[model samples]
Target: MASPQYRLVYWPGIPGRGEHIRLVFEETSTPYTDTATTSDGLDRVLAYVQGNVPDDNINPPPLAPPILQHLADPNNDTNVTTISQTSNILLYLATHLPPGSIAPDPKTDPNALFYLNSLALTALDGLSNEPHDCHHPIASGLYYEDQKPESLRKADNYVRVRLPKFLGYFERVLGSGASGGGKWLYGGKFSFADLVLFQCLDGVKFMFPKAVSKYEREGTYAKVFALYQAVSERPKITEYLKSSRRQKYSDGIYRYYEELDIEP
Candidate 1:
């Protein structure tokens, strides 16, 4: 209804590393524009990511997409502030925005945000980062076809070893008292960590449906899947999932490869 103060710079198509960032705004109904709605939108996003946007006070520019931009105090400076990296952006939003915006207030209980961020990073590390390497085992720039043999080997280890490690860790966390009996990841409260885990597993499901079905069918990692279900069913997130904003996974990190979807 109004001009959103927050802007999300991500690739136009695949979710890539941007979906978790989008989930924060969607779950909270926070106003955020995913890319600019203008002819210069692509150009501007590239400028920030490709080092065309010269640094003033901040020296390093964003080297990739999934960048977040918010206007500084209009009274002091009209320039938009840009920050990159998934976890960094999430932490920034949680702290810089009003308390209870994404996670607990850093001042009252620093441990809450600390735990939230820690869990989020763990999810991204095992589920997000490692999964990407499964397909592009040789190199990110190389096509999957060029590295099929390597992808198969990497994916076999991923689904057999890495996937269960991450899933089991979250499952135990959900069952622990700190998780408040499976509804939430920490203290029975919503956090961006929950969103991160959801996106990661959701991608896993897409990337390796057969492997996921084996676990689901065997009832392993039930708590993590339960948490995934709970997050997806949230009112705003539910709407967002069914909406056009939710892009399908394809050329991004999580990709479905028939041969690579090994049973764990």
Candidate 2:
């Protein structure tokens, strides 16, 4: 196989925020190198985070990892076209890659991109960021043990309140006829939004298995659960899940702590 035209720079050990971008690449079969597994990859990743990339042209360098760089063009500095932020990277891929890779063509339906983006953003907000906070409720900069008391309160509210709110919103979106009343999140077509939501749901299931089980048994968010099943069973995604590329959840966005577990 030919070398990938892109490079993904992110931390090596945990999937962290990079898994979102990885899903897009996996679903599209878009060949790309993950810097995490490469030699000095972490060092290279920190270079961008620390703004030590030796390039003076990359104005306002990215503040964090999961940076995507276009390697196909040599004239452009490796860091010149780098993009960070999971949602922003997904948007760039959705627009730049071949049609049907992850989303519909932006040329045909420009507005759909924004709409899908909004959906992705919402998922990250509720499913990703909030769950992460459940473990480090006081401050991400501090250890979970340092803020155990606050984390317990946050986890209770999240599983009991916020989780249902977000899930219900997506359920309505699926049933709203805006998704063409289909399994997809938009235009009755499988797009990046579906992929993103699937990942978020997967993370939630891992972190809050009991709560998700209760919700699934109630069947109130049937469409959301079905979407998760559909995305997981996709041939490419299925293969990706079983492959080495699919990183296991650890201390990342969705972490399961026995103390944080609750019955919803």
Per-candidate clashes, comma-separated: 0, 0
lDDT of 1 by residue, 1-264 (tens): 346778889877688788988999888788777863445667877787678877777535788988988866433435678889999899988887678766878777779888898899999999999999998988988999999999999999988888888999998999899888787898887889999999999999999898888888778888888888988999899999998889888888888888988887
Lowest-sum lDDT 10-residue window in model 1: 71-80
Summarize candidate 2's per-residue lDDT along 144-167 as a digit string, tens digits. Answer: 889999999999999999999999
Q: Estimate each model's TM-score.
A: 0.93, 0.94
Candidate maximizing TM-score: 2
**Model 1 vs. true fold: TM:** 0.93
* Local distance difference test, candidate 1: 0.85
The deviation in Å at residue 104 for candidate 2 is 1.8
Error of 2 at 166 (Å): 0.2
User: Which stretches in model 1 have alpha-carbon errors above 4 Å?
Assistant: 36-39, 73-77
The superposed Cα distance between candidate 1 and the true structure at residue 109, in angstroms, equals 1.6
